[model samples]
Target: MASTSSFDIVSDFDRQEMVNTVDQALREIKSRYDLKDTKSTLELQENAILVNTDSEFALEAIHTILRTKAAKRNLSQKIFDYGKVESASGSRLRQEITLKQGISQDLAKKISKLVRDEFKKVQASIQGDVVRVSSKSKDDLQNVMQRLKQEDFPLALQFTNYR
Candidate 1:
């Protein structure tokens, strides 16, 4: 029997890069004029980043800062894994942003479904928070990759584990 060539498709968001970007954004916030007074805050949990601000404007400014920093470092906005912004307290709002590397099980399932539906040639299965794609022919796998790239998925995708 011929061994099938297989690969895992996922978003390419380096966790370390994101951490570094967040650190730089924090530093910039402290130094920037408009942001300095707002006292915006950022915290990285296991799977997500928590942002807190005094007002909506401050929250947006912080978001912009994070986005710019990530973009400058070649990180995609799709990796942001954005969550809904909600009121935390009086004049305070909070946003929890998920990381592509630490994707939620629900999102992972969604991705796997998308890949299976979008790529008819390859077989895809959700393994924990990651999706595995396998195909007998490398050409089929390559075609799947190309199709994935053409579509706009909500989350950042990184391809890995090709064999």
Candidate 2:
């Protein structure tokens, strides 16, 4: 009998890094002459972020700052689902940015199917939001990881819990 090696594919981000990203962006907004005194604000929610500002230009600046900070922190740009700008009181504009957190069932199914079709030595199973891949050969597992990385997925993928 042979033992199998396995790993889990998950889509996640570091919450503390996100908090730091937002804090850094807020500091930049306060110091930047164009954004300063524009009353720009960034608020992080449980699963989203809220931005409020006086003008469209300021809003754009905030977005740039946010993106730059997030990138520097190694967060995927795809995580942000930007909402349309809405009117707020006293010539203010507001926008909501949603955070992408998990893999959908459809995507997990697609990944499992792909692995099953392409790799005879590998077995993939969908366990909740994660896809678990196992193989007797560690080389086969590495090949599976490489193949998955090549395919474009909407959310970021992190392989964990290797055993």
Candidate 3:
């Protein structure tokens, strides 16, 4: 057996699932009486989802629907960063929700520090967008995973490449 075992900590979400969530929400918007015929539009752009609706009320409804759909699909709610609502042409309102993918430098450092402070036997190093954690004992790695899940971070975290 290898002397050391390791895993990578990442913060990411499924783009296809996000797209599906948006599509389902739009369909519900069309069927609902309050949102139907509002000429509202929801589009999943390259990095963000764009929501165009007639009023703030309608946009709020869309937000609820989108969040609900995402939850049903097992997508993390923390991935959405909602932008300010702005007025578009023809009195339409627009909102952009940016999708958070990787862990930021500040967050990465925080995670590394957390692991080091908690687990002396484990070693954590930040590698670009992901954090690599390794230790000789597999039990230490399992404890680290359990500890991380208890924390309420701003983003969703996933563990991968465990060996």
Predictions in order: lDDT: 0.81, 0.94, 0.94
- Residues 79-154, candidate 2: write the lDDT tens digits: 8989999999998999999998878999999999999999998999998988999999999999999988898888
Residue pairs clashing, model 3: none
Which regions of candidate 3 are displaced past 4 Å? none
lDDT of 2 at 61: 89
| lDDT of residue 16 for candidate 1 | 86
Which 10 successive residues of model 1 have the least lDDT summed? 99-108
TM-score of each: 0.77, 0.96, 0.97
What overall lDDT, based on C-alpha atoms, would model 1 receive against the true structure?
0.81
Off by over 4 Å in 2: none
Error of 2 at 138 (Å): 0.9
TM match of model 2 to true structure: 0.96
Lowest summed-lDDT stretch of 10 residues in model 2? 147-156
lDDT of 1 by residue, 1-163 (tens): 8678888866567778888999999999899888888778999887789998888888888889999999998898876767999888767888998876645677777666876787676788877666788978899888887877786767777788888
Number of the top-ranking candidate, with TM-score as the measure:
3
lDDT by residue (68-137, candidate 3, tens digit) is: 9999999999999999999999999999999889999999999999999999999999999999999999
In order, how many clashes per candidate?
Answer: 5, 0, 0
